[model samples]
Target: MDLTVLSYVIYLFISIVLTVWVARTLSRAGRVFLAQVFPGSEHLAEAVNHLLVVGFYLVNLGFVSLYLKSGATTETARQVFEGLSVKEGVVLLVLGGMHLGNVFVLNKLRSNSRRDFAVIPPIPPTGFLPEVEA
Candidate 1:
C-alpha cells in the first residue's frame, strides 16, 4: 500500500477511536449534569443522554469523514505525521467546542429551571402595619 493510504488508515482509526472515547466520557460525566438540569427526572436525563450521544456521533463522524482527505501528498513518514497531527488537532478542537456548547445550553436550562421553581411570589406588603396598644 502507498504511504498515503497508510496515513489515511491510521488517521481514520485514530480519529474514530478518539471520537468514541470522548463521546463516552461526556455521556458518562454528563449524567449528573443532565440530572441536575431536569431535576427529579432520571428517565428524562437518560433519554436526553442517549440523544446527545447519538447527535455527537452523527456530527463528529460526519466531520471525520468529511475532513479525512489531505490535499498534500504523503510521500514521507514525516509528512504522514504532520498530516495526522493537523487533522487530529482540528478534530480535538471541534470536539472541545461541541462539549462547551452542550454545557452552555444545559447550564442555561438549569438556570431557567431553578429560577422558575419558586412557589410563592416575592411581593412586599402593600399596607403598613397597625400600631400596637401601649
Candidate 2:
C-alpha cells in the first residue's frame, strides 16, 4: 500500500481506539457525577450515563468519519507521520472539548438541583410562643 493509504489506515485505527477509550473513561466517571447531580436517584444516574455514552460515540465517530479525508498526498514516511500527527491531534482536541462540554452542562444541572433543594428561612422567628396544654 502507498504511504497515503497507510496513513489513512493508521489514522482510522488510532482515532477509533482513542474515541472508545475516552468514551469508556467518561462513562465510568460520569456515573458518579450524574449521581451527584440527581442525588438519591441511582437508576436515573445510570440511565443518563448510558445515554451520554451513546451520544458521545455518535458525535465522535461521525466526526472521525467526516474528517478521514486527506488534506494532501502522503508520499513519504515523513508525510505519513505528519498527517497522522495532525489528524490524531485534532481528534484528541475534539474529544477533550466534548468532555469539557459535558462536564459544564452537568455541573449546571447539579447546581440547579442543589438550589432547588436548598432551604434557607428568610428570617428567624422573633420569639418562641409558650406551650399551652393540649
Candidate 3:
C-alpha cells in the first residue's frame, strides 16, 4: 500500500484510541467527584461513569466515521495543511474543543464535590429521634 493509506490508517487508529482513553479516564474522575458530592451514594458515581463513557463513544465514533479521509501525501507541512478543507478543519477543531471542555467541566465538578463532601455530616438513624410523648 501507499504511504498515505498507511498514515491515514494510523491516524484513524490513534484518534479513536486517544478519544476512548480520555473518555474512560474522565468517567473515573467524575465518579470520584460524584462520590464527594453525593456523600452516601458511591453507587451513583459508578453509574454516571458508565453513562458518560457510553455517550462519549456514541458521539465521537459517529464523528470519526463521518469525517475520515482515505488518502494522504508526503509533502511539506504547509502543503499538507493547505490541502485540508475548511469544513474538515472546523470539524476537527470542534471535536478537540469539545474534548477540552469536557475535561474542564469534569475538573470543576470534582472540585465542587470535594467541597460538598467536606461540609456535610453523616446520616443519622430515623429511630434515633428522642421520644417526645409522655
lDDT of 1: 0.89
TM-score of each: 0.87, 0.86, 0.56
Off by over 4 Å in 2: 122-134
For model 3, how does the per-residue alpha-carbon lDDT over 60-128 read when each residue is reduced to its tens digit? 777767766634464654443444444345455656776787677667777887775577677877776
Models ranked on lDDT: 2, 1, 3
lDDT of each: 0.89, 0.90, 0.65
Backbone clash count for every predicted candidate, in the order shown: 0, 0, 0
Q: Cα deviation of 46 in candidate 1 (Å)?
A: 0.6
- Kindly report which residue stretches of model 1 are placed more than 4 angstroms away from their true locations once superposed: 119-125, 128-134
lDDT of 2 by residue, 64-104 (tens): 99999986988889989988899999999999999998888
Per-residue accuracy of model 1 over 10-127 as CA lDDT, tens digit each: 9899989998998898899888788887888999999998998999999999999999888999999999999999999999999998888877877787787777785687799899
Off by over 4 Å in 3: 70-96, 103-134
Flag the better candidate by TM-score, 1 or 3: 1
